[model samples]
Target: MHGHYRETAECPGQTRGESSGGTHLQMHGHYRETAECPGQTRGESSGGTRLQMHGHYRETAECPGQTRGESSGGTRLQIHGHYRETAECPGQTRGEREGRVVDGLTSKYMDTIERLQSVQARLEVKAQTLERESNECRVQTEECQQQLRKCQSELNRQVKQSSCVIQEKVPFNDTKTSDYNSLNVPPHNKRHQLKARDVAGQALGFVQDIVVALLNFHSYTEQRVHIYPLDSSIEPISPLNQKFSQYLHENAAYVRPLEEGLVQLHQSITEDTVTVLETVGKLKDFAEHFTSYTHFLQKILPYQLKSLEEECRAPLCTSSLISKNQELQSGMKRITSVFDKLHRYIILLALPSVRQDAMPQSSSSAVFTQLAACLHSLHDAIKEMSKHYSQKAGLEQQLPTVTQKLCTTNECLLASLGMLTNSTDKIATFFSNNLDFFTSSTGYGPRGGVGVLNPLQAESMLGNKKKASDYMQAIRKPRAESVPYREALLNRRVLTSSTESRQGLTQQVVASQEKIARLEQEKEHWLLETQLGRVRLEKESQRIQDLETQLSSALEGGGGSPASALSLGLGSPALTSLDDGELEERGVEKDAMINTSLVGMLTTTPTNEEVRDEESREQLIKTHYMARVGELTTQLQVSDSKAVNFHAECRALAKRLALAEKSRETLTEEVKLANQNITRLQDELATTKRSYKEQLSMMSDHLCSMNETLSKQREEIDILKLSGKGNSKLLKKGR
Candidate 1:
């Protein structure tokens, strides 16, 4: 049964044999495997094998006599009862010592076990603490997560609220701001415009009020006044006048002579006022006539009138209509009143002169003079009025022609433009339809369209059209004849004024010419003096140049002396003591004289070139003298300063030498101290070297002791090996 069981357990490829006697059996196979034995199944054998294995996976036979399986590596093995089997095993006493040693080892092992148990207890406590910390950390983590969630939710809420608020407020803010801005902007602009308009309107109203007030004042002041020139060769009534040709012929007053004179004066004022009133009346009639004519023309010819209507409205009719109108005015009434007032003022101012002249000049002459002035003024005013009338007539005659010409020209221009437009359109059509023909040879492809041009053809067409247009345009509108009329009026006024001024200035020029002649004579005197001064300046300049040359040579010479240079007048005795004080005084006096002379010469009105030359010469002379004095003063100052600085430097050098000597003594003491410190450091270095050598000797002794201990350990190891060999031999014998 055993053979059958063994055969069944061992497969064909396994090597198997029976060993020993019937009480013991040994089976071998290629490898380990679970198989059925005599009464055991493969499963039961596997279970029995497992039961035989210890907790450490050490396999021991379940049979009491069976040996345990051995695993071999580098470690030593000890049998249970062969404590003394090793060659180095101790005798009984030595065994006792070894037992004691083992006892110590056991105690050490127990201590290690205790330490391990204590370490395990501590680790368990620590683990409990770590677990608590982990739980707390987990709790903190949960709290942090909760806080993070809350923060996230809060942030989201805040973001959403902010978004909502911003969404709501942004438009509201923008709308409100826009509303505010618009409110401010429109009103501000409107207010500014209103202010400007109000100011302008107020200014216009003020100007109109002033003009109306002036007109009213003149009308009121002139209403009661009347005056006329007296006839000469009549007996004078006023004692103050003392004139044979003048008489007071006032019908209202027959009083004392003074009172009679006053009455005459008052009558004359009244006459002058009456004259002004008549002039104003004529001005008003003229204005009204023009205003009526303009109003009639504007009313009748609402648009432009035809030539027939203009021709039928004769010049006299238009003139009469304008003269009869009420608003065709240039404020002439106000001007006439102002002129009358001016005349009265002049008369009053001339009264004293008139009285004085009466003693010699006859009263008739005085009256004639005044009447002549009045007639002259009246003639000037009448001439101005005639010129204005002629200007108006001329303008009236040319206006229709200008307007007709403008209309005809505009129609012609429109026609020309229409023709040009048609030509352009035809050209454009040609280009668009036959684009290839214009640019077939050019690399630009079809370019006859409006955008593209055959350069020469386009240029020729444009040039021809431009030339024709320019030539046609050159047939200018007939130059407005009113321009010449205005020029003629201006020329007439100028000629009249020139004649009047020429006549008045004729007598006055004689006295003026004599005065000019005397001035010219005085100018000749100054001219002579200036010429002499220029000559002297030239001589002085030559002397200065000579002195400069001599001084330069003296400076260049090897052995020239200052005295020799002075003898040559390069260093004048007069200039030797001239410092800034004297130079400033001289400059001031010279400048004053120059200014006075320059003013006199300028007032004399010298010719342009003469003035230029004199200015250049004066500037050159002043610059030259001033530069010469400045150079001399600078040289003197530089030499004196050098001398002074040299003395100061000498004293400073003496003081510095004493200080340097004291510093050298201090350096000597520092060097001695450094030498002593060096000596102390050298001694300390020697002592340190000695101590290092002693410590090295002690380390060498320790190494020798360690070598002796290693030698003893080697012998003990050899003994152990020999003992191991004996044990192997005993085992072989036993086998």
Candidate 2:
């Protein structure tokens, strides 16, 4: 029979043998020598070959080649070549060589298979580790994207709100000038006067009352009027009252002088008609001068008084007061000159006439003297009036310093207020600039590029306009669109999260499938190993049966030696039964021992209970797994609910954003309307101011025209008076 043997120096306890006669054997430790194989020294001689084969196997196992198929084929070829060389000796038969080659091929094939399995296991482990890392990377990427979206949304919202607030805060300053203009117009018309005819008529009426009173006095006293007090009620009072009373007493005493002067005038008139006419002409001239004087007083004095009062009350500048004082002094000089002319005219009229009248000389002389005295009193009254005006002017002069101080204080206050307003405006501008900086610095659209909006950009877009409502509306339109844009972005984020979750779930399922596949492969490998062990055990049993049959055959042929017989009979039942008592004793002993061992086993190894415990543990594990699954399901449901709530909140936020956008739009529209109204009002104010200016110009032109006309009329009157004088002189010369 041909046999193959394997020897491993590293594992001395294990041995394998294969026979061409259909006997395959495996052994552990040293094998006992059998009598049939006493001459065979094959085991010792094959040890070197077995050591070589083990070294080859070790080499193949330690340094695995990249290509399994090629390496295995090459190793098989090398083993076949080694076996062929070993079998190629001259004395070797073809059968042994073929069996050796077949054995070497089988050994090499087993090594290749083991190497492939180990390589596959390592690859599977690496693949699982890589998949886990990839899943972690995916989760981190998703988290980062979500964070980015949140930051972007928050930034956009803040920018929009800031822009809205900025749009809401712009100011208008044209109304103040209009108010000031309206307040200053009344003082100009306050100084205008009534017509000259009306003033002259009033003066004429006053003259007529005076003339009637004088005539009544002359008739009642029979051309003699007493200068004393008429009643006890008359008394010295205030200076103004005392002056008037003294004038009345003096007028009463002067009535006699006036009668005497009138008697002298009557005698002159009776003596010569020419003299009478000349005297009448002189009286007419005096009347004309007095009437002119009264007209001047009535028409001009009140305006001058009002002007002086206004100047005194007003807080005019020092330079203006000084100019006004000079004007007043000049006017007083003019008035004093007119009074002196009237005084000379009065004295000339009071002189004794060239021709005497028919009346008493004494009465005429008394009348002339009384009239002169009355004229002197009138001159004194004029001087007093001038003095009163001078005193008023002086009083007004004293207030110039106070008025100047007040003006300076007012100017300083106005300047301070202006400075404060300017400073506040500058502070607002600084804050606005800061806001613009923040707005501009914030990133918006994409890839950290330029921002969506900034205050400076908005202002620039609005083109330096005072009103930015239109620009705000334009901005709002885009911002309104951002609501939907943000919603879409949120939806996309949700979808991406769901997709990532699904990918994670799929990855988990794939990992689980890989684990299940690896477990199934392990189970199949274990079952194959168990089947190989069972087949090896059965082969060994068959080999032992064959050995027993051969021994029996040798004994039956009567060729077996006694020793061989003894050796064979060692396993026979008859020999074993011959010592029954001792065997029985031993058997009893064995049975007792076995029984004790069984009892010990029964006591020590509670297999059923252990199995029950294991099953309970499994049940507990299953229950725990189920509870975990339930918790996870509940968590998933809660997460879904949270997602739904988040979606609802996002929707609500979107609605609020939309409402805010609408409100912003409304505010922008209102602002636009307000801007339009302000512009319209400014235009109206401008037009009104232009009209007022034009009206003032027209009034000034008309006043100048009226002044020129009055001057021309006065010049014409003077010319006419000169012509009348010349004509009268010519007429008098012709007569």
Candidate 3:
């Protein structure tokens, strides 16, 4: 070793150097650079730490006092040429594989979130449909309930019709007979169309057709209210048919032929009973028509009056009753009020002869039987009066002028009837108007709620997706501290917040699951409500169908038999016990022992001995009529009870419908809240994964960078060794 390999050391700590042929190497303090043979190059750094390149881009660096067991920024790594082991550090490999696993988990989680969002969208739609259907059902239920109420009112009116017949026309005490078999009549008069046997516990008039209410002709009453009580019986103003009773007492001979021809002139009483009974049923139906109309007024008027008073008191009310100036005697309110009071007072005037003491609630058979007995008594009275009038023989001579007088009085009665019909129509129209006003003033729908969410409900669910994705993907690989080879990057700090974030994510998942279970319960409840409503609707529809059938038969004149019209009148007489007085006498209405089934037999039968005796024949006739009256009275009591129960069922169904709709609305709200929570949880989970992934990615990058730097230094060391060997040979040759 001579001057050719001599050291003019420019390196740190007096390091060795070589410059031979075209190769030169120099080191300065802690920095070194080399140029070896045309294109070869090297670098070195040494201070408190050592950094060196050994061969083919291999590198190593170690701090002072660092040992083989510990890490000191030293790693073995290099890029091989054609085929060799790849440049990879243990830390980077472990970190990169784990990061990939984390990435896969993130992708799976995001997929789950997207799927959950779609499911929530579908649930929202389903909830909306249920809300819509329930609303529609509620609306329909309201309408049906109103219609059913109206129909029920009408049906009740049908049951308690024609109170006037029971209240007056026949005196009850005069018709009463204690002994039916006193004038013993045997079962002897068995004709072709009529039977002689009288069935026990059956009304005489109901079983055997005899002249009944129909045989009593329409009579002109003395009282008249031009607009109001032409056909009605009101107290003090327009008591019905009073003049007819007076006429019968006063001018008995003038109108006697009509009754005598029908009742007395029949070929045989039993043979002609069918014709008489059919006519009586129809006459009863027509009489009941007017009476039911009065009853309708009784029901509707008070309600309308209450409504008028309520309307007058309501906020922003413009009712005519509210204006004192318009409520004079000439006003509509005054007129209607008078009509209302008079209609209610009509019962008081219907019988001026001790009406409270009078037995009123007689059935069809009872009415007919009582009328028959009274007519028989009257027949005897007419004959007795004729005996008195026959003494004064001018009664036959005065017939022509009497006929003219009777005709004039009949014309006046007809005129009053025309006026009564017009007034009744007006009152009905007024009552309907009040009903409309009351319904409008109240927000009267049964189902009440606005629970369904709008279409924009989904807007807040997927909150700021762009911002979320950016946070999730934001990452730069990390770097080690104070390394000279590569630029330092921000080292990921210890994940202190990770534990808290993990716990928070777990809580979110648990909360979402709990909400899901609650959603399940609510959804089941909603579905059950829907099912119940559907079932109730079907039942209501069936009830309406039966009503339609009954109404149609009545309207079509009762299906074509002679008894058809008769049945329509006698069939299913409504007993409106809920509102109107179903029975005129409460004690009489409780006929618990009454048989509904009609036994078609007369109570009394005339023997030859009884028929021959005039007083016995009359007594036998009276007993038959009284027995029939008692039986019919018993039957009327039974009908009134059944009608009361049917109405109660309708009310309960309506309440259930309202309850079902409210439950459905609550379920919809719960589902909406659950969907919101799920979306929030999805966002939170995505955020957590992004934070964890970013931290892990940074750590992998830092380890990879360190490993790569060490590999390059090792490669540099190999190249420097080859240059030193060549220089040593050149130095020897030069020596």
TM-score of each: 0.13, 0.19, 0.15
Query: Residue 74's C-alpha lDDT in candidate 3?
Result: 22
- Compare the candidates by lDDT and give the number of the best one: 2
Give lDDT per model, in order: 0.44, 0.47, 0.39
lDDT of 3 by residue, 383-465 (tens): 33233223212332233333444345444544433333222332233334333321221111111211111112112211332
Clash count for candidate 3 is 33
Could you give candidate 1's per-residue lDDT for residues 1-735 as a string of tens digits?
A: 343333323323222222121112111210123321345676776555444323112211122233222211101232222323433554445457568889999999999999999999999999999999999999999999999999999999999999999998776542234222221111012333343344333333322322333233222212211110111133322222222112122211211222223233333322112111111122232233323333322332211122123323444345443442212132233334334543443343333222322122123244334433443443344334334434443444444433443334333333333332232332233334433322222221111211222222322433444565577678864776565888999999999999999988986898899999999978855665566467546765886797788787876673667666665543556567776599679757754555466522522347553466467656755665588799999999999999999989999998899888888888887886676456435544654676687778777788788888888889899999999999999999999
Model 3, which residues run further than 4 Å from truth? Answer: 1-608, 611-644, 692-700, 703-707, 710-735
Model 3: lDDT of residue 99 = 88
Give the residue spans of candidate 1 off by over 4 A.
1-644, 723-735
By summed lDDT, the worst window of 10 consecutive residues in model 2 runs over: 184-193
Which whole-number lDDT from 0 to 100 does residue 255 have in model 3? 30
Which ten-residue region of model 3 has the weakest summed lDDT?
444-453
Please give the lDDT score at residue 36 for candidate 3.
Answer: 19
Candidates in descending lDDT order: 2, 1, 3
Any runs in candidate 2 off by more than 4 Å, and if so which? 1-608, 717-735
